[model samples]
Target: MIYLDNAATSLKKPQGVIDAVVSAIQHSGNAGRGSSETALQASRTIFQARQALNQLINGHDPRQIVFTHNATESLNTVIKGIFNKGDHVISTVMEHNSVLRPLYELEEKGVELTLLSINDTGTIDPEAVNNAIQANTKGMVITHASNVTGDINPIKKISHLLHQHQLLCIVDASQTIGSIPIDVRDLDVDILCFTGHKGLLGPQGTGGIYIRPGISIQPLKSGGTGIDTFSHHQPIDYPSRLEAGTLNSHGIAGLYAGVSYLLDFGVDKIRDYERELLNFFYQELITIPSIKIYGHFDSNVDRCAILSINIGNIDSAIIVEELIDRAEIITRGGGHCAPLMHEALGTREQGVVRFSLSHYTSKEDLLTAVKCLKDIPKDLN
Candidate 1:
């Protein structure tokens, strides 16, 4: 089947990632609990993963990185750990439910929040975010890229502004990591959340957070960290402060391989390739009178491999079913866990079909998708 749902989870993981995961599971034991040869190997594997992630993001210290189950959990750790009652926060309407739900729950607990509106192109104005800040504004949370529209927000500028205002900057980079060129130090983001399965091309259940130095947040979970066994309180250090319980060594080994592969391939090369495919798909699909595309048509303003569209007189679910059953193509059709984006884009009533490409996606796949979509029976029963 022709898989096009890379934004949800990439199907074409690098061979190195698969091999690394399998090898780690076969050879390594519990990472930090013992001193045996197998345990030492596992510990080294985890350290290597941290180093790979640090290099990928141009981070200063590898110890600042903390692994989690997924981006949702990482985001929760940041949202719940940092802010307190009466604290004001600023976010955009393009946020996924991972960000939106936590903010909504915080709002109910008397934490003030301001959600900046986005234009029809799904781009948020940094100036609007600056204007939304109040005296109590403790943090500014922004999504590096919209999952539904694939619009890249102006993060560096926002980060600069937040720094000037002395407010913490939290970025949700789940959709941009590995596909976009991001330097944690250059971006000046205080907290960056990421997932390994999407653009990183790693196995699921691998994700992490990068907390800038000098910033402290309470841990969401507290237990034995294999360090500071005698202390009742959780260790107040970089990773040990955040990480609790046994880590996902197998998934992290795969993630390390995936990140190394991306570094060798160069992020710019992957991005350019995906852009070519997106442009080809957009230009060809626009000619079909029955097809309606979402997001900005201009590749410069809003750029990513993800595209959302709908066929006239057809339900999105029906289109997805037809694409899979008849055309042997795989695509996702639903709100994509970004209900607020759907509400903003006017696709809440009927969720649009999503075709999210990756570096492995080719021109031939786009052509096949276009042909299959054009061949959908015009007459609706």
Candidate 2:
């Protein structure tokens, strides 16, 4: 099957990633739980994974990389950890549910939320963010890229703006981390959350967050941190303060390998190739008379290798299912777990079929998929 649903989770992982996980399960034990060889191996694996992630994002300290089950958990840790009652926070309508649900819950607990509107093309004005700042405004939490529109935000510019005002800058980098050349220090992002399963090319259940220096947040949970058992409160340290139980050592082993592969191949090469493939597919899509594509299709723009479209008024889920059944094309449909973005596009009801391309996607496969979608208008009738 032609796998185009990579935005959800990259179904195609490198052989190194698979091999690392298998090795970890075979030889590694609970990290930091014992003095045995297996336990030591597990501990080393987690440490190395943290190091890889640190280099991947050019973070300040490897110690600040807090691993979690997924981006949702990582985002939750940051959202619940930092904000408090009556704190005014700025966000955007292009956020995925991972950021939305947590912010909504915080709103119930008294955090004020101001969602900034984006243009029809999914681009937000950096000036609007500056205009929204108030006395009580604690900071801004923004997505590095729109999962629906594949639009890259000017985070470096926005981060500079927020820092000028001494406000916090939290970035949800779930869709951009591995695909985009993101350096925590260069971007000046105070808190950045990401998932390893997507662009990282790692296994599922692996994600993390980065918190910059001179910043503190409440722990989302408290438990044994493999050190200082005598302390009553969570350890006042970088990762130990946020990490509550045994880490996902095996998954981290895979993540370590996955990120290393990315480094070896180079993120720039991967990004450019994927963008070329997206342009190739889009060239075919734009010619379809009945197709209405969402978001701007600019090859020069640095966006994710993703495209969303609809043929006539057909239900997107139906199109997605048909592609899987008849065309053997794997894709994502519906609101894409991004209701606010769907509402913004006026596709909340009809939804839109999404094609999240990957580095592994082939030209032949893309042509076949485009041909199938081109015939969709005929099939609908």
Candidate 3:
């Protein structure tokens, strides 16, 4: 199948990723729990993953990054741990359920929440965010890019404004981490959540959070963290404090390889290639009057390679099925876990047929998708 679901989880991983994961499972033992040769190898793999992550994001220290099951978990850990009752927070309507749900739960507990509205183009105004801050506002959480609309947010501007207010900034970079360039130091983000499988091209169950120094968070799950075994209390370190369970050595090994591949190719190169594909798709799809495309159509937006659209009179599910069954093309449909974004875009009822591209997607694949979309009957009754 010609997979177009990179935003969900990249299907075509770098060759090194698969090899590294398999090699780790075959040769290495449990990491950080023992001193055996196999265990040492596993520990090295985990270390390399952290190192790769640091290099990818320009993080301060590798140890400050904590591996989690996925971006959702990382977001929840930060949202629930950092904000207490009576604290106020700011988020955008473009946020996925991952960020929205935690903040919603906090709202019930008297944590004031302000969901800033976005324009129809899915762009959040940084000035509006600055206006929303109050005396009790402790943090501002925002997604780097809309999972549904692929609209890139002005994170740097938001960061600057939030810093001026002495409020923490938490960014969910699930859609933008590997696809776009990000420097944690440059962004001044307190907590950054990212998924490995989406942009990083790693296996599923691999993701992480980068916690800036001076930000303390309670652990989501307290358990054996290899360190502080003698003491009953969890270690009060950057990663160890938040990471309270055995690491996902195999997935992390794959993530390291994927990141290494990106490093060698350069993130700019990947982004440029993907932008070419997105621009081509956008230009071509707009010619069809029956199709309604979402997101910032301008290529200058520096957006992700995700496109959300719908053909007139065709249900999104049926379009997805046709793409898969008739064209041998795979794409995603429905809200994409960003119901707020879909609602904002007026696509909640039918959702949107999403064709998310990757660096691996070729001109031929785009042509094939375009041909299929053009051929589909506009009247689906």
Candidate 4:
């Protein structure tokens, strides 16, 4: 089967990642829980993973990197913990449900929310964000890139504007983290949340958050942090403050290997390869007049390797089913979890079929997918 749903998760991981997880499962124990050799091994693996991720994002310190189950958990920890009632926050229509649901929950509890809409090019304008700021506006929560459209937002520009107003900037980097280069210092983001399973090529349970120094977020969860078992409240330290209970050390070990592979191979090289595949597929698929593609596709622009399209008012699921049955090509269809983006694109009812590529996605895979799409309407009839 030709897999093209990498935006959801990386099905093909590096060999080093597989080896690391196996070794960790065999030898590692609970981190920070004891002084045994196995426990120490677990602690060291987690620390190495933290350092690798910190370097990947050019973070200030490794301790600021807090481990969570996935990007959704990291986003929830920041969103639910940072704001209080009466505080205003700004976001965009391109957000995933992970960002939107928590913000909606906060809005119901009296936090003011202003969700900025996307422009004709299916991208958010930073100036719109600047205009949305109110007297009570404390910060903006935004994605570095849209999951559905794969269009990148002007985060650095938005962050610069936020700095002028002294408002905090929180970025969801789930789509951009490993495929795109990110420097926390350059963006001046107060918090950055990411998942390991997508662009990072790590295990699904592995992900983290990077908090800029001096910003304190309330703990979304509280329990045994190994060192402060007697304390009623969670520890006030950097990682222990946010991290509670035993971490997924095996998955984190794999994540370290994944980051190491990216470092050695270089993220820029991988991005260029994936973009080649995306453009190749796009050029071929757009020849058919019945197909309508989404997102900005200027060759000069740099965006994630994602393409979403629809065929002549057909339901996205039906097209996906045909691809699966006829050619065994796997792609994601239906709503991509960004409800506002679908509404803006006038495709709320007919969700787009999303084809997300990774370095693992080959030129041959794109060829097969293009052929399948071109013949779909004929086969459906």
Candidate 5:
């Protein structure tokens, strides 16, 4: 099958990632649970993953990184843990449900929310973010890039504006973590959440959160951390405070190998390769009549390797199924968990077919997919 939905999860992973997971499952023990050799191996692997992520994001300290099941859990932990009844938080319409639903839950409980809107270019204006701040504004949770439109947000510019107002800046980097280079210090974000299965090319059930120094978030889960067992409350530390229960040591082992591979392979090279494929697909697909592509394709802009489109008001689900039956091509359709974005783009009813590329995607794959897409309108009539 030709997999084009890398935004959901990566079907292709490096050999090192596979080998590491298998080795961990066979020999590793629970991390921070015991001091045996097996347990020590698990602990070391988890720490190594933290170190790699810290290096990748240019973070201040490795210990501040905390592991979670996915970006959803991480975002929930931060969104729910940070704000209270009267505090206000800022975000954008471009957010995934992972960010929106948690904020919505808070809104019901008296927390104020302000979602900035996007312009014709399918991107948010930093000035709008500055204008959204209120007296009770506590922080902002912004996505690094839009999963639906592939429009990259100027996070650093927005974060700088947020800091001037003394508001906390939290980022959901789920779409651009490994695909784009992010320096947390440069971005000036207080917390950054990411998943390993997408751009990191790790297995599912692996993700993490990074909390900057001097910033404190209440623990989302509190239980055994293997230390301070006698304490009634969770340990007052960076990771242990956030991490509870048994850790996913095996998945983290794979994540470590994935990050290491990316470090050696160079993220820039991966970005360039994926952009080449996206450009080729866009250039060919734009030539077809009755096709409406989403997001701006300005030559000066740098965006994610995602293309969302519609074929003459055709139901996105039907179009996706047709591609699958005709060429075994896999793509994502429907709302993509971004109801606000779909509403902003006026595609709530029809939904758009999303084609997300990976480094593993090739020119030949795009050529075939484009050919199939070109034939779709003819087949329908």
Candidate 6:
């Protein structure tokens, strides 16, 4: 099968990732719970994974990278924990459900939310951020890139602007973390959330959040931390503050292998190649009059290697099912969890068929997808 649904999660992981997960499950024990050999093994593996994440994002320290189950958890930990009642936060319509849902929950709890609007192509102007600021606006949350349209946000610029207003900045980098180069220190972002399973090319059940120094987020969930068992309150530390209970050591070990591979291979090289595939597919898609592709298509633009399209006015689900059955191609269809984005694109009902590419998605794979799309009309008859 030709897998193109990488935005959901990367299916093809490196060999080291597979081996590391297996080794972790077989040999490692609970981290920070004991001093036995197996426990120490788990501790070391998790530490190494944090170190890899620190290097990948150019974080201030390894301990600043707090491991969570996925980006959703990381986002919630920041969104729900950082703000107070009546405080306002800013987000965009192009955000995933992870960002929107928590913000909605926060709104229900009396925190005011200011969701910015995106253009028809899913790009939000950075100026809209400056305009949304108010005295009650204590923080801003923006996705590094749109999962639906692959539009890359100017995170550094937005962070700088928010900082000038003394607003805390949280960037959800679920789509841009590994495939795109991100330096937490350089961006001066307060918190950056990521998932290991997507662009990071790791196993599932792995993700993290990077918080810069001097910024503190309250613990979302509190439990045993091995050191502060007696204390009723969660520990006020870098990692232990956010991390409670035993981590997913096996998945983290695999994430370490995945990130290490990206570091050695270089993120820029992977990005360049993926862009080549995106452009190849986009070029072919635009040529077909019946196909409607989303987002602003610019060959020189710095966007994620993803595309959203619809075959004529046909239902996206039906077209995706045809591709799966007849062409052995896998693509994501429907709203994709970003309801506001679908509304902005006037595709709330039709949804979209998303094709996300990674370093391994080749020219030949895109060619096959193009041919399938081109012949879909003939089959429909």
Number of the top TM-score candidate: 5
Give a tens-digit lDDT track for model 4, residues 32-144.
99999999999999999999999989999999999999999999999999999999999999999999999999999999999999987777788898899999999999999
Task: Please give each candidate's TM-score.
Answer: 0.97, 0.98, 0.98, 0.98, 0.99, 0.98
Candidate 6, residue 92: CA error in Å? Answer: 0.7
True-vs-predicted CA distance for residue 297, candidate 5, Å: 1.2
Residue 321 lDDT (model 5): 99
Q: Which model scores highest in lDDT?
A: 5
List runs of model 5 lying over 4 Å from the truth: none
TM-score of 5: 0.99
Cα distance off (Å), candidate 6, residue 185: 2.0
lDDT of 2 at 225: 85
Greater TM-score among 5 and 6 belongs to 5
Report the C-alpha lDDT of model 2 over 143-164, residue by residue, as the tens digit.
9988997988889899899999
Please write out the lDDT profile of model 5 over residues 1-381, one tens digit for every residue: 899999999999999999999999999999998899999999999999999999999999999999998999999999999999999999999999999999999999999999989987888888999889999999999999999989999888999999999999999999998988888998888999999899998889999999998888899999999999899999988899999999899999999999999899988888888888888899999899889999988756778999999999899999999999999999999999999999999999999999999999988898989999989999898
lDDT of 4 at 227: 90
* Local distance difference test scores for all models: 0.89, 0.90, 0.89, 0.92, 0.93, 0.90
Residue 311, candidate 1: C-alpha displacement in angstroms: 1.4
Model 2: how far is 67 from its true place, Å?
A: 0.5
Clashing pairs in 5: none
Q: Write the per-residue lDDT of candidate 1 for residues 1-381, one digit (tens) a residue.
A: 899998899998999999999998999887778899988888898888888889989998999999998999999999999988999999988898999999999899989989888965578887887888799999888899888878888888888988889999999999999998889989989999999998888889999999888999999999988899999999999798888888888999899899999989999899888888899999999999889888886767537788889987577888998889766899999888988888888788789999999989888988999988888855443
Off by over 4 Å in 3: 378-381
Provide the global lDDT of candidate 6 against the true structure: 0.90
Tell how far residue 126 is off in model 3, in angstroms: 0.8
Better of 4 and 5 by lDDT: 5
- List runs of model 1 lying over 4 Å from the truth: 377-381
Each candidate's number of clashing pairs is 0, 0, 0, 0, 0, 0
